[model samples]
Target: MLKRRLANTDLEISPLGLGTVKLGRNKGIKYPTHFELPSDKEAAQLIGLAKELGINLIDTAPAYGDSETRLGTLLTGQRQDWVICSKVGEEFDNQTGQSSYKFTPEHIQFSVERSLKRLNTDYIDMLLVHSDGNDVEIIKRFGLLQVLNDLKAQGKIRATGMSTKTIEGGLLALQQSDCAMVTYNLTHADEEPVLDFAAQHNKGILLKKALASGHICTHAGEDPVQASFNYIFAHPGVTSAIIGTINPEHLRSNVAAAEKAILQQ
Candidate 1:
């Protein structure tokens, strides 16, 4: 559970971050199986266990149903103990089970303000632009990165980045911001160049869909979880991999596997 400095930022994060999507939303997700949202007590227990296991990074978003609110309640009075990474540009509707994206400066301002209110926090450690697949256009056309940097300058956010979808966009994001969240599992190494750039430039890179949303973990009869972690941590630029497991056993097992992977490095 050793921590790494998220490059260009003061925040130090664990190798494996706990993604909180499962704590709030259950509809229209890509997980292999169906699941009920965890109760408040259950969510609190999971968060506590994660903190005890040396996990200080928690990834959430307005698009993740009520995750921000739940974490806000669960982590009250202990906000300083963790580095919270939340996102803007995407919002989820539970009743319709739909998602919407808006990256206008006004919407970005509104989203960050609402997230601050929902999380019951004064500032976010990292604020990422939750892209809607039009990564290049979002950066070039909308100018949301500038808005994020403005927020950073205002002390509302410590760092700014984008959860990018394309190689060009990932590179561009790194050039303009503090970090980039890119996909880089064993099956998805197309984003490896993004990691290389981050490593070369001393920027941060957080991995998303590192296990292919739990669909492609196993490979050639190997221990799927171990193999996945091994591939993820073998790279030099990955600041952390966001794992969204709600099961306590799965969390523990993932941490163990990640630790082993890091030790091998």
Candidate 2:
């Protein structure tokens, strides 16, 4: 697990990041299987294991039911050893099991402040706009990127970007911010243009759904996981591929696959 400098930022992160949605939320998820939330001890163990496996990037969001809170508790003393990447714009409600988005300057500011409190950190390493499928509209209409930029200046966050859904929005995000998180996997290469642009411009690119949310891992293939990692790490634009796997064995396997993939590259 080699670390790559996140373009336009001083932060250096591993090629594979751990997505923490499953650590806090279980409802309204699209995983192939259902499971209960792990206890604090179990979650702490997972975090420790990730660190042992050379994963420095941890992606979490306020929408991920208490993920920030748990990480705050779990990552008590070793916060500096990890690069915390969190998001704003999306909020989840446990009662309805639904997520809502707000991209106003006021909401964005409030969300980042709250995330800082919840994650028990003074400043977040990376803060991305959690787009609600209205990627272009949200970035254009809300002026949220400016707000995020302000936060960066204020030292609340180090870098800013969007988890974009469309190529148009992805390109726009990279133009305006430090990076863009796009969906780039074996099944979905719709965002390749975005990756190409990042490569050309030297802007950061963090890939979400790198394994198609675990669906591709189950597909019939010789080694879909390895194949996915090879495809992802092979791309020069990728800063890191965020994989949400709670199982320790799965995480280790993924790291192994990602390491091999990077070596092949």
Candidate 3:
């Protein structure tokens, strides 16, 4: 339940955010184990549990199937109590069963508008580009940063960021936007520089895949979840770790581990 004020924004986010990927999309994921999508009632209960645990940040995306719409229905009257983060670059196609990436300024605006309507909210707390690799090229050729800046200026989103796949893109995202989402866990330390940059520059850093996409292969007697949270929150730049889990007991354990990690810190 520890909070950090995200840089370049007025939002105060919890150290562990509730990632809503499993609430919607299930196919074509890289998670270690196949998952059954949670029911609407289950998801609503999960959302309530997350909020009860004092998690203020909810991460969803257009690429996450109907996550935004589910949250819109589930979150109903709790809009003012949470900071919602959605994405622009990639969209999930239910028919083709695949995700497509588009970042033309036209598409960017269109995505923002659609997200606003889907989320049943007037403004997004933050918007990130869901990258499909080629991150540097995407930023250089697509005018994504400018378009997101424009959206922010227009008050459609409060902040802009990129869920980057590489170090170069992470660095570029931090330089050009309010935050960057990067993968950082015990097995992967390559993205630490992005976190270091975020710390040095006072930019926000949202850690993705911190538990290594649920393929957390740990030695006997080692608690991967606790260890992952400990390693992540040890870094000052980590604004939050976006963990997607629908089970209430798993959520409770994660929260307890996160609290312990913060207390130890």
Candidate 4:
């Protein structure tokens, strides 16, 4: 695996990181039946396979129902080697079948503590503020950046970042916070100025939704996986791309894309 330095942090993460949104539930997809959650045993085996295959970064969020818990259970004794990036400010309600965002400082603290407990780790490698739309409101309501600074000082979280769905939100986060930024690749590519701004500021950039919600790889000979992965990897500012898959074969295929990128680079 190719390793890249996350901006202003000591952590060196793999170019390909695992996103756990699918591991929990098919959030945006409609299905006749609820998506089956992976068993703990299977999750553990996959985590082991990931480690063995040189994948060092695993990104999860509290909003990803049971994902953090499952990862925690799987990674109980092997926490030191992995860069476990988790998000706060949002959670999933199983009964309501919806996600709710919270931004109070109290709620932020509560969320982090719960994450720590669920992750079975004392400190997070990278803690991201998961935002829905109101970046300023969310930042002000919780003073989240300040809280993250305090947590860093207290050694509860090594670094902080923001995961946003908008270019405006990405730029605002970069201007206001010293932490890193995560955003969708397709939207970001369309807003090159924001990406350039982040690069100029030395802000770490992580690309999510790299596969365009599976639109990239839905047809024969299209190979959206490789195309999307390479597109993001070729972007100078992007440090890593998060790709999610439950199938081991598909996972290997994604890993092959990363390997190929490294060789070409």
Per-prediction CA RMSD (Å)? 1.0, 0.7, 1.1, 2.3
TM-score of each: 0.98, 0.99, 0.97, 0.91
Kindly indicate the candidate among 3 and 4 with the higher TM-score.
Answer: 3
Per-residue CA lDDT of model 2 for 142-195, tens digit only, reads 989889999999998999999999999999999999999999999899999999
Q: Which residue runs of candidate 3 sit more than 4 Å off their true CA positions? A: 217-219
User: Which structure is stronger by lDDT: 2 or 3?
Assistant: 2
lDDT per residue, candidate 1, 1-265, as tens digits?
Answer: 9999988688899999999999989998999889999999999899999999999999999999999999889999999999999999998999999999988999999999999999999999999999999999999999999999999999999999999999999999999999999999878899899999999999999999988898875455888889988998888999999999889998999999999999999
Question: What C-alpha root-mean-square deviation, in Å, does candidate 4 show against the real structure?
Answer: 2.3
Pairs of residues at least 3 apart in sequence or in different chains that clash in candidate 3:
none
How do the residues 148-252 of candidate 3 rate in per-residue lDDT, one tens digit apiece? 998889899999999999999999998899999999999999989999999999999998998887777344578988988888989998999998888899899
Model 4 segments more than 4 A misplaced: 27-34, 176-181, 186-188
Please name the candidate that would achieve the greatest TM-score relative to the true structure.
Answer: 2
Task: Tell me how far the alpha carbon of residue 2 in candidate 3 is from the true structure, in angstroms, after superposition.
Answer: 2.7
- Give the alpha carbon lDDT tens digit for every residue of 1-265 in model 4: 9688887789898988887776776654443334567777777777777777778999899888788888887787789989999988887886677988888888889999999999999999989899987876677666787887788889999878788766676776776554445555543466455567777887777777777655566646756677666667766777777876666777888899878866665
Span of ten consecutive residues with least summed lDDT in model 1: 215-224
**What lDDT, from 0 to 1, does candidate 1 have?**
0.93
The global C-alpha lDDT for each of the candidates, from Candidate 1 onward, is 0.93, 0.93, 0.91, 0.76
TM-score of 2: 0.99
Q: Which portions of model 2 miss their true places by more than 4 Å?
A: none
Q: Tell me the lDDT of candidate 2.
A: 0.93
